[model samples]
Target: MASTIKPVLPTSYKAAVIEAPGAPLKVIDVTLKKPGPSQVLVKVLACGICHSDAGLQQGHFGPHLFPRVPGHEIVGDVVKIGGGVSRVANGDRVRGTWHGGHDHTCRQCHMGLFQICDNAVSNGISQDGGYAEFVLLRSEAVVRVPKDLDPAQVGPLLCAGVTVFNSIRKMKIEQGNLVAIQGIGGLGHLAIQYANKMGYKVAALSSGSEKRDLALKLGAHEFIDSSQVDPIKALKELGGAALIIATAPNPKSIAPLTGALGAAGKLCVLAPVGQLEINSFDLISKAASVHGWPSGHALDCEDAIDFARTHGVTCLVERFSLDNAQEAMDTMIQNKVRFRSVLVMGSE
Candidate 1:
C-alpha cells in the first residue's frame, strides 16, 4: 500500500507540525490526502496531548523524524475509506490509538500482539497523527466509538483511559483485590475509577493531601498521602496491594512500592521513564514481579471505551485549539493539565 501520498487538491487543511527538534509547533496549511488501500481518513474532532509527545520534540526517536504531527489519542468521525476496507463506513464515530498500523504477517502479529508488530507503525511518530484537522488511519487501528460521547472527553480514553483499563483487566489480580494507583495525574485519575468500577478495593496514592478528597470522590476507597507517610507502609497496613499501578513517571518513587506487593502480587509500571531499582530478594520472596504494558489494540480500545462509558468513568480534560498545540503539549509535559489536555476542532 502507498504511504504518505500527496493530495490532488491544493492546501486542504491545517495541522500543528513539528518543523524541527526543539521548535514550537507551527500550524500550517497542507494538502490533505485520501486513504490508501485498507486505510481510513478521519475528520478529527479532538486529540489528547500526551507527555510522550515530548520525545518527538526532543529528537529522541530519531534520525529524521521531524515535520511530524504529534498526537495519538484521537477521536474523530470517519469520512472516507480506501479499497479493501469493510469494517467501517463513512460518518462512523471512531478513535485512532497509538498502535497506528501493524504488519499482520509478523511473528508477534501471529500471536495476536499487533501492538508490538515487527514493523509496528506508531501514530504521531511513524506517521502524521491527529494534531491536525484530518488524519489517515490504518483500518486495523480505527476503533468504532460512540457518536453521542463528547470527543474531547473520550479522546484520552484512546490512550490514557485505555492504557489503564485494558492493562488492569489483564493483570494477574482479580476483582475485589486491593489495587493501588500511585499517582493522581492523567493516567492515575482514570485508573482509580476503573479499578473501583471493576470491583477492586481502590486506593489512590499521591504525594499530598490536596488530591485526597478528589481521589475518594473518584471512587478510591482510601487515599494514601505519601507526603505525610510512606505509601509502602500504608499499602502494607492495608494487607499489601494485590496490584500496584505505577503511573507516576519517576522510577525512584515507583521502585519502593515493590515492597508493598503481596504474595504473588504484581507491580505494573506504565511509565517509560528511567530504570527502576528493585531488590531481587523482595520479589523472589513474594513471587512478585515488575513489568510494563503497551496500550492495547483497536478491539481492546473498544472494550475500554464501552466499560468507561457504561460505568461513568469520565476523563477530566482541558481544551486547546489546534493553533495552541505547543502550549497543550507543554502543559501536559509540565504536569499542569488537571488531567488530560485535548485539542478541540470546530468548537467541539
Candidate 2:
C-alpha cells in the first residue's frame, strides 16, 4: 500500500561515466529505467567525490566493470517510490551511503551489521551511483536527511563523516582523554571537530606546518608537524594519546603513530591504506590495540548528521558541476582540494 505520486520520468539523463579503467570520466547521456519494487528514484542534488572514487577509477580496487557511474556519497530528493516502499516518500530529502543494498536474511544483517552483510551491494561500485542527473536507489539503503541541512555539505557525511564518527564511537574514549588525529585531510578534519566536541583534548598531526592554523580553527587543542619532530616522542611528552585515529592513507605515516599510544590506548585506522608494518612489541608494551572501522548503516549516518548539526561541524568543500567531475576528482586524487570536492547537480 504505497501512494503513487511520481515526477515526470525522463527517458534519458546526463551522467559522468567511466568507460574503462584509467580513462577519464566522460559526460554522456544514459537511458533511464523505472524503479522496481522496493526501489526509489532520486533526483541527485549533490554527490561527494571521495578518494575511493579515484581508486576505483584507477582500478586500484581490483578490476571494475566498465561504464560505471562512480559516486557513493549521495544526497537527493525522493522523486518516486516503487510499490512496497514505505521508508520514504516523494518530496522527502534523503541520502545514501557506500552501504547500499544487502540481503536481510544474512547473519550480519540480522545482527544489524548491514554494512558488512555477506551479499552487500556497493552503491557506486557494484551499481550505478549519483554522478548523474538522477539515480535509482534501493529504498532500504536510503536515510531521510534533515531538510534544513545544506545538501552540498551533507553528501560527505554519508560516507567519510559516518566512517570516522562510527570509528571514534567504537573506541569509547572518555572525556578529557588525549586524542590524536593524523592527517588533516578530508576525514581527519571532521574527526578533529568530532573528537573535540566529544570533550577530548584533540591534537592534529600532519606532515608539515601548513595546516596548523586550519587544524586549530577546526577545534584541535594542539597541532603537531611530523616532519619537524618525532611524532611518537611528541605524543609521549604530552602524556601519550588515549586514542589515535589514523586518517592518512600512507602506511608509512601510520606505522609510527602506533607507538604513540598510551597504556590501554586504542589506534583506530579509518583509511583504506593497505597493510601496516607495526612493531608488535610497541603494542604489547603499552597494552594497546589497533582496529579498523568501515562505513556504518543508515541509523549511524543519521546519528552522524544529527551530531554534526547540533555541534556546528561541517566539511569544507570545493564545488564542481557534473560536467567537471573529472577535474573535481583529479583535484581530490592529487590532494589539492582544501578538504572535500562535491559535485553540485542543480538547485533544490
Candidate 3:
C-alpha cells in the first residue's frame, strides 16, 4: 500500500548532481520540500541511465544547465501529495514518464497528444530528475506501478520499454510479418522480444556474430551480421523485412536496411542517429516510410508496463547499488552493460 504520511520535519536527502558537462557527479545532501498543490513527492527507488543522459552529459543534446541530475527512467513510491492532488495517494508504487508535467492548454493536448505539449518540462532534463532520494512531479505525470513488479527491473521500462512498445504499436505488424531489429543491445533486445510477442517473424541485425545466438534466444527467428555480409541482401533473400527497427546510434549502420524494407514497409528509428542520408527515389519507389518514435505519454507508458506483465516481458538488467552509479554510467557508455543497467535503492 502507498504511504500517505507527510513527515513534518524537513530532512536532508541524498542526491547525485552533475555539476558540469563531462564532470563527475557529486553526491550532495539536499532538503526536500513538501509537495505543493497539484504535486506529489516520490521517494525514488531506482532510475535507469539512458543514452539520452550521455547526450546531456556530453552537451550533444544542447546546453543543459549545470547541476542537473540526468536520469528520466524513474520508479518510486508516492509518499506525499499536495492539496487537491488525488490521482495518487501516499505509498503508491509509481513511475514517471519523460514529461514532468504537461500543460493541458496546448492544441496538442486538445487532440489527446499531451506528450508533445508545447509547454512540457521533462524530468532529469528540464527539471530536477530521479537521480536523488526524492523528486517532485506534477500529479499528471505519475503512472501507478503494479505492486508485483520489481522496482529496480522496472526502471528501464519507463523509457526503453515504452520506446520499443510505442514503435512496435505504430508498426502494426501482422503475426507473420517479417520484422528485423537492428543492434541487439538495450533497446534492440527489448524490441525483438516485444515484436516476437506481437506475432511478427522477428530477425535481429548486428555488426558481429557475438550477439547472434543471444538474439535468437531472445525470440528473434533469424540473425544477420552486417560485417560478414550485406544485411540488406540477406534480409532481402529472407523475404525482406516488413518492419525494421533501428536501435543503434549510427545511421549508416541502419540506413542500408531501408532497401530491405519490402514494398510499403516501414523503418522505425528508436535511437537518435546524428543524421540519415537516404536515396529518396529508392524510398519513394519502394513506398517505404521512415519513422521516429520517442517516449510516449503517461498512459501509454502504463500500457507498456501492463503489456510487459501480461506477456512476461522483462529487461535482463545488471544491478548496481546507488553508490556505484558512476560505474554503472561508465558501463553503459562502454556498451558493456548487458541488456540494461539499473540502480537499486531503498532497503532490500
Tell me how many residue pairs clash in candidate 3. 5
Model 1: per-residue Cα lDDT over 260-322, one tens digit each? 999888999998877788978879999998878888988889899889988999999999999
Question: Model 1 — TM-score against the truth?
Answer: 0.95
Give residue 281's error in model 3 in angstroms: 2.6
Q: Which candidate order results from sorting by lDDT in descending order?
A: 2, 1, 3
Best by lDDT: 2
For every candidate in turn, the CA RMSD to the true structure comes to 3.7, 2.0, 1.7
Give the lDDT of residue 329 in candidate 2.
94
lDDT tens digits by residue: candidate 2, 1-348: 223666787899999998888989999999987889999999999999988888789987666477799998899888887999988989899997898888999999999999999999888888898899899999998988988888889999778888888999889988999999999989999999999888899999999999999999999998999999999999999999999999998899899887899999999988877778988988999899999988799899999999999998899999999999999998998889988999999632
Residue pairs with backbone atoms closer than 3 Å in model 3 (clashes): 2-90, 2-91, 2-92, 3-90, 3-91
Q: Deviation in angstroms for 161 in model 2? A: 0.8
Query: After aligning candidate 2 to the native by TM-score, how far in Å is the CA of 263 from where it should be?
Result: 0.8
Model 3 regions more than 4 Å off:
1-10, 62-64, 346-348
Candidate 3 TM-score, true structure as reference: 0.95
